[model samples]
Target: MPEHCAAFSCSNRRTIASRARGITFHKFPKDKDVRKKWEVALRREGFHASDTSVLCSHHFNQGDFDRTGQIVRLRDGVIPSVFSFPVHLQRLEKGRATSSSRRAEESLSVASQDSQEMATSSPQPQPNDVNISTLNVIS
Candidate 1:
């Protein structure tokens, strides 16, 4: 019987070695029971198993790994897409800023329209009667 390793470091070291060379190695335990245990551990740490191989911190640093190679486990227990926390947050922030700016622009447009209406409705003095008496008094 093959001995089972409980620590992830062993698998991680091997994964790193494989990734650094741009090659995949099947060093991880292949037994169903061993895989089940690993899967449980990975899930506990917010990881998901999909058709593609699972990667640890070591695999992430490798040259062969890219955004397309990453994975995220969704709330519905499905591995939906690639995982990049920084990228995700940046997109969210940008969207929020854009929405806020749009709202501000709309409000400004409405205010300008109201101001125009007020200006148009207000009474205007005739040119000949405009402020001559006030100017004389000031002089």
Candidate 2:
């Protein structure tokens, strides 16, 4: 298929041959220290692999690199962690704002309904007895 996957040694050969040809490969380290460094870097970059037993144990033992410089089986199928404090706060603020707005709208609606009812129930002013000349002068 593609030039990159055409190489027989490429692990993604089958995937590349398929209709969905995109394959992302991660490089693991052979050196233990280097592997640890890579795992630490991933952790720093908000990759929460600590909760998973497989990833944590692998990274703890062999770092991220195996004997062949390939990424270890650890941390496979783990969803990327999101560590955005600002985004979380923004979501909370938006929720609060929406709730407050809804409450305010409900209060306004109730007040309007009350006013409508009052208007409907109250006695209307008489056209003949009212002082139109005084009302015009005040306006």
Candidate 3:
């Protein structure tokens, strides 16, 4: 079992022997930009991720979980950002980065917030609305 979580200042260890029953590990996203977002949220030190670097379930929101208690299958372009670091942990987790890196993180955070707002503010589909494809075809 892994010793710790990969999220910034997260120390939660796997509690169960079974991989399916306990805290889960999620690999860094395949997309480079998305992967960078995770790294920025981590706010850690000397961290360079290779192909297999992972963040555990504790860092992700409950919505990211599946009914089986495993991380859900993510849709294309989805990214995880439901975590928060403690104040003390925040101090401990700070890592040095260039100004460009800082700007990148700030922009990422703002853009994510804006997108989330748009998603929630959008109207839900009406149940009564039906598409022509759903009706029986007349020959």
Best by TM-score: 3
Alpha-carbon lDDT of model 3: 0.70
Q: What is the lDDT of residue 61 in candidate 3?
A: 68
Local accuracy by lDDT, each model: 0.44, 0.42, 0.70
lDDT for residue 49 in candidate 3, whole number 0-100: 69
Best-matching candidate per lDDT: 3
lDDT of 2 by residue, 39-136 (tens): 55344344332321111221123332243545334343232222223342333344325878889988999999999999999988886777667775
lDDT tens per residue, model 1, 16-72:
455676433222334556555546544335543443344433322244334353552
C-alpha RMSD values across all candidates:
16.4, 17.7, 13.7
- Worst lDDT 10-window in candidate 3: 69-78
TM-score of each: 0.25, 0.24, 0.47
lDDT of 3 by residue, 34-99 (tens): 888777777766676678677777666667655554445544555667668677645455754799
Which residue segments of model 1 deviate by more than 4 Å? 1-97, 132-139
Over 4 Å off, model 3:
1-3, 13-21, 66-71, 84-139
Q: After superposition, how far is residue 54 of candidate 1 from its true place, in Å?
A: 54
Question: Model 1 shows how many backbone clashes?
Answer: 0
